[model samples]
Structures are given as structure tokens and as C-alpha cells.
Target: MCIIFFHFNPNSASAYRLILAANRDEFYSRPSKPADFWANNGNILSGLDMEKGREGGTWLGISKKGKCAALTNYLQPVINMDALGRGYLVPNFLTQDMDGLTYLKKISLEGHLYNGFNLLTVDFSNTKGDMMCYYGNRSDQEPRVLDPGIYGLCNSLLDTPWKKLVNGKKLFTETIKKSCALSPENLTQELLNMLNNEEYQLPVTDIEEQGQDFIRPILEEFSALFIRTSFYGTRTNTVILVDAKGHVTFTERCLLKPDTNQWKVSSYQFELET
Candidate 1:
């Protein structure tokens, strides 16, 4: 999805080193396959993009190696829809064993191939000094290694001062502090509740944007922690928790449409490679 919130702690004493909650936002018309541990040799667990077929890739994915990646667009309006598939970035990262900084450095060399995008990659290859990085061509030319902390990403950039990002990160930090006992279900549910937050709305739309006039009228309506609009809104919410002992839990709550009363929730647990 377009928004992601993740906490990374490199401490070996902590039960969970990485906890992530995110939502995927897209137009209702775009058909996509739901998340699953895909059948094949790669064992890639992610939602398949039916539109792009095998090449479509995914918005987010985690491989068997404990490697994870997710991407968000930079909110830059580009008319050429066929420039390059930004969705491929995550799947590509998941299939490899490279460190976060190494992979990001290579991608930065080919940054011109795709439109503005912010990528988040986590490297659990090394049990000690685990690395998480934010690479965004629009936000900054240099790749930034994320320190152990809570961070939020939206359609803009890595840690941009968006209303939802700021609020979500704050609430997320508070939750982490209060739930120090490591109650997995409670903590993840708290994140899910935050994804349903509909508190803030933009008062006005920036007319400087090149060509998103269609959603301009309802821009304010879609400006909350969880977006709600008929044509475009949150389609899926995913939560992932990884403990220092190599245990991992991945969950996905899927919604077919914006106002559907039915939601399909699935959870999968696995172990990371040592």
C-alpha cells in the first residue's frame, strides 16, 4: 500500500526486532491477486499483481531469508504510466540475499528508470547490527540507514511531515511503550485500529499538482490515517512481527471494496534462516 509504519530494534534482548503495519491504497478498478505464499521455487510470499502478470511483482513482500521490502510512490504525478513498474522493486529485493545498503546503492544507480519512489528494505541477515534503510530519489539523493526506532512512510517520502505519518508514528511509539510485555495480538490489533483512524482531513487541495483533478474534489476525504473514498481507498492491511529468535508472524486483512462488510483475515507464522 501507499502507507507503511515499522519499528526496528537491533537489540538481541528484545523479543521482536521488527514489527510492521501497513495498508495498500489503490483504485477499485485495478484487479490484484491477494497475498499468499506463491507456489514455485522462490517461495515468495506476496500479493501478485494480475495486471502485470509475472512481471507485475508486488507492492510488498518477504522472502524465506527474513528479507523484507516495501515501496511507496512520491506523490509526483507522471503521465507516462508505462515508464517502469515500481511494484517490481519489492519482489526483486525479496529474491536476493544482499544487504539493505548494498541493494539500495545498486537501485540508486538505476533511479532514473522509475518515477519518484521511496523504498524501505530490512536486512536480518546479520543477527547483530541488523540494517533497515530508506532510499528515495525524490526525498534525498543519498540512501539513509534507519536507526533503531519507529518510522512512518506515506505517499510523499521517508518520514515526510504528513499529518497521518506524524500522528501514526506518535501513536505507534506510545503503543510500543505501553505494551512493553510483548503482547503480540494486542499490539497488532492496536496497529489495525490505527489503520482505521479517520480523524484528519485536508482543508484544501494543492492546485499546483499537474493532473489529478478527478480526486481533487474528494482529496480532503482521503487525507486520513485510513483513506475512505469510493473509487480509491485502502484495499488491504498487513502486519508483520519478527522476533530475535527468528520467529515471524505475518497477517493480512483483505477487503474487496471500500464499503464491504466482509473482510478476510489470514495469518502465517514461519522461522527465519539462521
Candidate 2:
């Protein structure tokens, strides 16, 4: 997930406890499977990154046991290709038995094993209460629990207030307010519409301003909520809503072919098994 907008209302008496919308940007040629329950585990639901030799990894995923995780790469001028693929972070948390805090601590200890990335993990099955934790290896902050509120993340640190993240949060808040009384399908459509927005343009940050001039065009293309380029762009848009009753609605819209305008959508609903 390259960009995400979410609201986490753990204490809400309303219909939903969590609502999330995200876009996954990647190279068009990279192969991936659409969102579905894993054939092996059955309990895990996510799209699989089928890039060569890095199968079984995912950018976002949720378990039947009320665990969910999503990851986004942190912006860096250089990346360590020899490090672990960050896609595995989501499924690793989803399949594990640890709570959000414990699992994040574990990841923190071995953060150097992976490239720079931001990770969000949730364990709604906690006996005390649901928990959400966020960690970014590139950040100076430690893994910390998030309070109930709206948040946004992209290639930057969590809630960095990039132009796109700020605008996305506003749109997301509006969609949630308008969809309070709508049906699940209607709400999903509204969120999808929000993700399709591409008007916001990112200003050159201090780092990008100092970088070489040749990279500016690529950053300009990436500024939109919905990015499109000949070789790389937003490949998937996903919406996940979990109600107060532990019912989950997951919907994914994916590009049907590389560098094409066609898209395919898949949706799933399941009650949490807690």
C-alpha cells in the first residue's frame, strides 16, 4: 500500500470500528494475484505479490481472527535490494499469534532486516480491547499505539501531512460522514470514488528540492492520489471496513492488464471469528 487513509474508532458505539482505503502503486509489469482467501490458510485474505522469487508476500492483509496489517515503503533516495522484501511484513503479522504491541516490538528489533517501510498492525481480538500499532523503520520514533482518530500515510512517515495525505484525509472524513447511513456496498463505492481522486499535486519537499532535476518529473507523476505512468502506477485500490459487530467488508479494485485502463473488482465479507 503506497497510500492509505483510515479512521480507527475503537470506542465508538456506531456501526464501524475501522474504515480504511488505500492505493497500491507499483511497476505495471510486476505480477500479482487479486484479493482472496489464501488457498493454504483459508483464514488469511489478501492479494499476493507474485514477483519472481518473492511469492506469498502481500502489501495488506487481514485474518479471520481479527488481525490486520498494511505496509508502505518509506521514501528513500537509495534502497538496499539485498534486504528482505517488505511485502512479507503484512502476512507475517496476520498469520502470527502475537498481539499488536508484541509483534511490533519483534519487528523493531529486526528492523534492519528490511528496507525502509511503514507498517500498521491491528489486533481486534485482544481480550482487553482492540489495538492498533504503527512503526516505521526510517522514523526516529518508536513503535507506538495509535489513539482513536483519522490518519493518513504514503511513501512518507505516518501522518507526515504531505499534500496528498492531507487532501485524502479530508475526502475520507467526508465520505465517512456521508456513508454513516448507507449500505455496505454503497459505502464501499463512495470510498472507491475517493481513492480515484487525482487532483492534488505534491509540492517539492526540502529533500526532493535538493535532489537531481531529472527525478522531479517522476515525483510530479506520483503526486496524485491516483497515479498513472507508462511503466509504473497505481495498480490496486482497496477498501476495508470492519463494523462494531466484527463483520468485515473487503473490496479490491485492480488493473486488469499492465498499462491499461481496464479494471477488475473483487469483494469479500466475513464475520470475525473472535
Candidate 3:
């Protein structure tokens, strides 16, 4: 995940409404497919990175139990090729029977086994509600629960305000507040439109947090939300919405070519609780 902007709980009218629009920036030649792809081991749904050189894992995935997770690579000059594939973390969390806090605590120890990365997993196993927690190997802070609010994340820490993170957050928040009560279809459309935004032209930066250099140049394209470059650019855009009742709707749009508006879209819906 390169650019992810989300509204955790933008208003008081709702108990919980998580709306996330993300853009996956990568090399144009990278073989990937965006859809509700699932592995044979379980009914877990996510996109698939066909180039199996690494983990062949997914950047985001949702389990049959309504566990939702998304991961972003921590920008660094160094590469730990032997580290565990960060993409596998999402599916692993979904298949494993563990709460968000417990899983994050255990994974934090082996965080050094992989390169720096940020992982956010929302556990809805209780059937009562969902719990969201954010853990980053690069951040100095410990694995902490996030407050009820909108947040923007790119290559930097959670909300490091890298121009795009700051501006994109405002746009997403405003859209959430203005809607009366958005249906899943309506909400997904709104978020997809937001992801298609190519407005901001701010150059990417090398942000230093806690003495770590985080540099993501993909954010330097024509837009802060959707990025397009020559060799490497935004490969796919995904919109996911989960409401208070555990009803989940996921939609993804993938582009084969970087310069065309063509996209391959897929959607899935499932109830988390009876």
C-alpha cells in the first residue's frame, strides 16, 4: 500500500464506520491481480501478487470472520531480503485465531525479521464489535489502539503529514460528514472517486522519524491519492467499507497499463455475524 486514507469514525451518528481508499504503487511490470482472491486454505479474500519471488502475499485481506487488515511498506534505504514477507502478515492474521492486541504483540517481536512496515488489523471476532490496532516496526511507539477518527497513512508513520496525508485526510473527512447515511454502494463509489483524485502535485519527501529515514517517491506523481509514473505507479485502487453491524463490502480496481483509464473491477459482500 502506498497511499491509504481512511475515516475510522468521522461522526457521532454512527457507532462505527470504517471507510478506506488505498492506492497500491509499484512497478508497472510487477505481475499482480486485484480482486477478492482467496487461497485454498481458507475463505480469506484479498488481491494476489502473482510474482511469487517474495511472499506472494496480499497487501489487504478480509477473513470469513470479518477480520480486516492492510499493510504498507516502511520506506528505507536498506532491504532485508531474508525477512518474512510483510504481505503474508495480513493473511496470517486472518487465518490465526487471535485478537488484534495479542497478535500484534507477538508479531512485534519478530518485526525485525522483516523490513520496516506498518500493519493495521481490525478484529471483529467478538461479534459484539470491532477493535482496531496499528503496529509499525519503524515507529518508536508501541502497538497502540487508535482513537475514533479519520487518519491518513502513506510511506511515513500513521499520520506524518507528508502533504498528501494531510490534504487527503481533510477531503475524506469532509465527504464522510456531508453524507446523510451512505449505503455500501454509495460509500464505495465515493471512496473510489476519492482514490481517483489526481490533484495534489507535491513532491515526495524523505521523512525522518525517530532517527529512521522514510522515503516514498511514488507520492510525487500528479496526485496525492492516485499516482502515475513511467516505470512504477499506482497499480491498483481499493475501496472497503464496514459498518457497525459487521456488514462488509469490498471493491477493487486494477489497471494493466499505467497510462490508460482502463480498469478491471471486482466486488464482494459478506455478513460477519448472524
Which 10 consecutive positions of candidate 1 have the poorest summed lDDT? Answer: 202-211
lDDT (tens digit, per residue) of candidate 1 on 116-205: 788999877554567798899775468878888888988777776666678788877887776567577887788888787887645434
Error of 3 at 137 (Å): 0.4
* Model 1 TM-score (2 dp): 0.91
- Which residue runs does candidate 3 get wrong by more than 4 Å? 10-16, 37-42, 125-128, 203-219
Candidate 1's C-alpha runs over 4 A off are 53-55, 126-128, 204-215, 257-259
TM-score of each: 0.91, 0.95, 0.88
Report how far residue 2 has shifted in candidate 2, in Å: 0.6
Candidate 3 residue pairs in clash (backbone atoms < 3 Å)? none
CA lDDT, candidate 2, residue 156: 75
The Cα local distance difference test for each model comes to 0.77, 0.86, 0.74
Q: Between candidates 1 and 3, which one is better according to TM-score?
A: 1
Alpha-carbon shift of residue 51 in model 2 (angstroms): 1.0
Model 1: lDDT of residue 97: 67
lDDT of 3: 0.74
